[model samples]
Structure formats: C-alpha cells, structure tokens
Target: MSPRLLLLCLLLMLPVAALASVALGAASLPFGEVWRDVVSHVTGGGRPAQITGIDDAIIWGSRVPRTLLAMVAGAGLAVAGAVLQTVVRNPLADPYVLGVTSGASLAAVAVLTLGPAGLLGPLHLGVPAAAFVGACATLALVVVLSRHQGTTAPVRLVLAGVALSYLLQGATSYLQLRARPDQLSGVLFWLLGSVAGAQWSDLGLPATLVVGCTAWLLLHGRSLNALAMGEETAAFLGVRVHALRLQLLAVSALLTAAVISVAGGISFVGLVVPHSVRLLIGSDHRALLPTTALAGALFLLLADLAARTVAAPMELPLGILTAVAGAPFFLWLLRRDRSAAGREV
Candidate 1:
C-alpha cells in the first residue's frame, strides 16, 4: 500500500480507536450513549439524557483524560523512536533502549520526591523541566562517551547509552529504597507508568510537543532519510550531518521528557510502533513519522484499555504491558535479522 494511503487509513482509524477506548471500559456504556455524551461535553451542552450518574463522571472526568494521555504519550514516544532510529541509524535505537527515558525517569523521580519546587515552584512544569534537562544531559553524556575521536560509532553509542541507563536506574533504585513508605507506591507507579491520574489541564504540553515535534520531523524528512544512510552519505548530500544529529537529539529528548512527565515511564511505544509502521509503509520519514504517530496513539489507547479492563478495577501499569508485548517482538526481530544475515552469507 502507498504510504500516504496507509497514513490516511490510520488517521481514520484513530477516532474509532479512541471511541472504543472511551466506551469499552469496565463500566460498559452503549457506544451511542458514549458518543452523545462526548459530543455534548465537547460542544458545551448539558449532559445527554439517561446518561446520568457515575457513568457521566466516568466518561467525562476519568476516561477522557486517561484516553487522551495514552494518545499523546503513544504518539510522542513513537515519533521519538522514529527519529532516534534514523538519527542513530540503528533499528534497535529507541528512547527506552538508548536510556533517554531512563534519564527522564530519574529526573522526574528526583523532582517528585526531593521537591525542586524551591526553584521551579509548580510541580507540573517542574517535573517536565527536570525530565527534559535530564534527558538532554544524558544524551550529551552518551554522545561524548560514545564518540571515538570526533565521530560517533553506532555500536559504541548503544553501549554507552545502555551503561548510562543502568547507572541512572541504579541511582533511582537507591532513592526508591530511601523513600518514605507513604511515597513508595507513588514512586513505583511513576516508574512503571500510568495515566490514571490525568487531568484535562495536564494535556497541553505533551499534546503540543507531539504535534510540534512531529511537524518538525516531517519537515526534515529528506535529511532524516539521508542520515539513515550514514553520516558520510548525509554530509555528502549537504545535510550538515553533525548539526542535524544534534537537532534530532534535542527534539527527541524534549518529546520524550514531555511524555514521561505526564504518563510516567511508558516504554516500547517508541521501540515497537515505528518498526511496525515501517514494515507496513516503508521508511520514508515523511509518511513513517506521521503514520507512526497515529499507530502509536492507537496502540497505546488499546493498551490502556487492556490495562484498565484486564485486571478489572485494578489497573496494570502501562510500561509493564508494553514491555510484555515489546520483549517478544524485539527477540523476533533479532532472530529474523540473524537468519537474514545467515542467508546472505
């Protein structure tokens, strides 16, 4: 299928997926009623008839925010993954795999527990700010450590990112051990990822980041394609390879930070969604980027639905769910690549 056609189909599917997400929760409202309620609420009309009581609250107050968060986080992480893969020229590169989200997680945990309010005041902005700082700092450190002479080797970059991820995680674990019993659950939940506590007000920054970063990425599609071919080739194409890498790293860090801030440490959306889109639509970033964003949003919306419903009233963490799904896919990709290499040899 044409990438544009695939993207259009995915774009059309998003609203359906969203509607299902909002409707298929444990409460089990009629789709028509759910639609009416949503339309009424969005249009600033009164609550629709016969949809009164807890269902109304469930749809408008709880489910809407949670669903929106899933969409935003999923899209942002997927686009980040697409950018990282192109920037690093590694199929396995992702925010989680490369330690970007780990860095963001560490910073967010610190801010939530240690209280950076002394400097930032509002915790909402402070957490994302702290996470963005941590992500960018981690990316810089990874680049510096991974560089041999003046050039970044992809394998070395991955190794450095993995090492840094472990170090950051170890520090986070130590802090977790010292956390007050009352605060422990909060810390654990954030680390595992959830959007259950989402509020309408919390949607602004992540949504903006996803939209803005995706637009920026689409604009640089040709450069991304060149970079994926390698820095030498990209530079040969007048792509300013080093500058482009820096730009992508910064944008990816910012997008990842915005996501982890609100949704906690949701993983694998970045890793899996982009690859899936690439398989379906090929690797043109112009299409791959936007389609990946939509697929990510849909995948996470469905995953959130599973997270909420599979355990009944007890919700599983979004990160755990994605890891469960992503790990096998990762192994499969590795095995397939090895087999392909063996065939070539």
Candidate 2:
C-alpha cells in the first residue's frame, strides 16, 4: 500500500481504535456513555477522582493510560529495533537481543520480592528504571567484550549479548525459585511483562525519550545510511564511525530500557514492527523511522484493546498478545532469510 493510503487508514483507525480501546473493557460500556465521559474528560472535566462514574474512572483512569502506554512502548521498541538493525548492520538485531529485558526482569523481580518495604522509589521509574539499568549494564558489558581497536564488531556483540542473556535468565530463575508462593505471581508479571498499571504520570519520560530519540535519529539519518554501506565507507564519508555507533547504541539502549521497564519486555514489537516496515517502506532510515513509530503505536493500541477485553474480568498480559501476534511474523522473516541465503549460495 502507498504510504499515504497506509498512513490515512491508520489515522482513521487510531481514534476509532482508541475509542474502542476506551469503551470496551472488563465492564461493558455503552458507546454513548464512553463518548460522553471521554469528551468531558478531554474537554476539561473535573479531577479524575471527581468524575463520579465507574465507567469514566475505568475509561480515563485505567484503560486510557494503559492504552496510551501500549502506544508509547510499542513505538519506542519499534524505533529502537530499527536503529539497532542499522547501527549493528545485522538484520537480526533487536532491542531484546542484548539481554536488556532479562536484566530489567531480574532487577524488577528483586524489587518485587526482596526490596525493603516502600524502598523502591517512583512507580513510573521503579520498574522502568530497573530496566534501563539492566539494558545499560548489558549494553556496556557487550561493548566491553565486543570492542577491539575502538571498533564494534557485530558478531562479538551478538555473542556477548547471548552470554549475558543466559546469565540474566539464570539470575531471574533463581529469584523465582526463592520467592514465596504468594510473591511468585508478582514475579511472574514482571517476567511476562504487563501494562496493568499505566497512568498519565508514567508516560512523560517515555514520551520524551521517544520523541527526542526519534528526532536525533532523523537528524543523523544521513550518517546512519552511510554506516549501512559499511564502516569503511562511513569513515570515508567523514562520519565518525565509532562515535556514531556509541551514540546510537546508547540511545537505543535507553529507549528500549525505558519501555521494557514500563511495559514489561513486550516481545517482537521492536523486532517484528521494524522488519515489517522495512519490507514495506524500504530501508531509508529517514522514511522508515517515523513510519515505524506510528505503525508500532497503532499495532500495540489495538493489542492492548484486545488484551483488556479478550476474555473479560480476567486480564490478558499485553506481552502475551504481542508474542502471539508477532511470532508468526517472525517465522515468516526467518523463512525469507533462509530463502535469501539459499539464493546467495
């Protein structure tokens, strides 16, 4: 589909999906009621607590925040993935490929099961902060292991990521093993990932990160394209190859860490969305970055919508739905990769 038509369709779908997102949930709400509550709220309704209607509470307080989180997280992950694929020059590169999620999970599980009472500060930052730390930690380690002569070699980075991934996973498993049965469920959510607790307050940092990182990426698009041609070519083009790689890595790591902290390591969004967008829009980072962000947001908003109402009363983990949805796309990518390899051979 043409980008114009695709964007137009998505634009039309976003509000409808957003309204459907606000309207449908564990409690059935009439469209008129939802519309009224939403219209009033956005049009300067009273305090959230003063809304005085249960449906409105769910709409504004719970579902809207959750749905908005889904969008931010999805868009963040997708853009981060695209950046990684380009910076690493590895088609298979993804946000989670570097053990960042595992690191975040380990930190969150520790906070949930072992931290001092009320010791974990900042709900918006607590989990996400842990995730950011995890991502940065693994990223630093991977770079340390991978670097030689101030150059980042893709194979070493991947290997280091795999190694840290196993180590972090091991640590998380140990935490799960040690937790009380009642405490186990909390750990499970951290492990599986969720947007069960999204609020307006939670979105500020992430939104800033997404918009800022996106702008930075677009500004650096020419360098990114140069890098894509190969390290030698990028250097010849006067792109400070190492500095560029470090900046991209730092930005991508922070972006992924922020969302995974808030959204719980949503699977395949970063991996699948960028891959799909690249297939559709071509590999020009200038064009690819913005398009992926919008598409990713739309994809996850709908996924969160489905998560809330899929079974009703019982909530579905947003990550579960993303995986269920994105895994098939991943398989297709693998198949395509194999076909391309065979053709080359």
Using lDDT as the measure, the top candidate is 1
Best by TM-score: 2
lDDT per residue (tens digit) for residues 1-345 in model 1: 688798888888888888888888777788888888999999998688778868888898888888999999999999999998888777778997678888888887787677786324675447667877777788889888988988777778789999999999998888788778887888888898988888888899889988998999899999999888778888899998877887898898889888887888887888889887776677888788889999899888888888988898888999888888777875675566664324421
Q: What overall lDDT goes with each candidate model?
A: 0.84, 0.80
lDDT of 1 at 268: 82
Per-model TM values vs. the true structure: 0.88, 0.91
Model 1 steric clash pairs: none
Where in model 2 is the C-alpha error above 4 Å?
A: 47-51, 116-125, 330-345
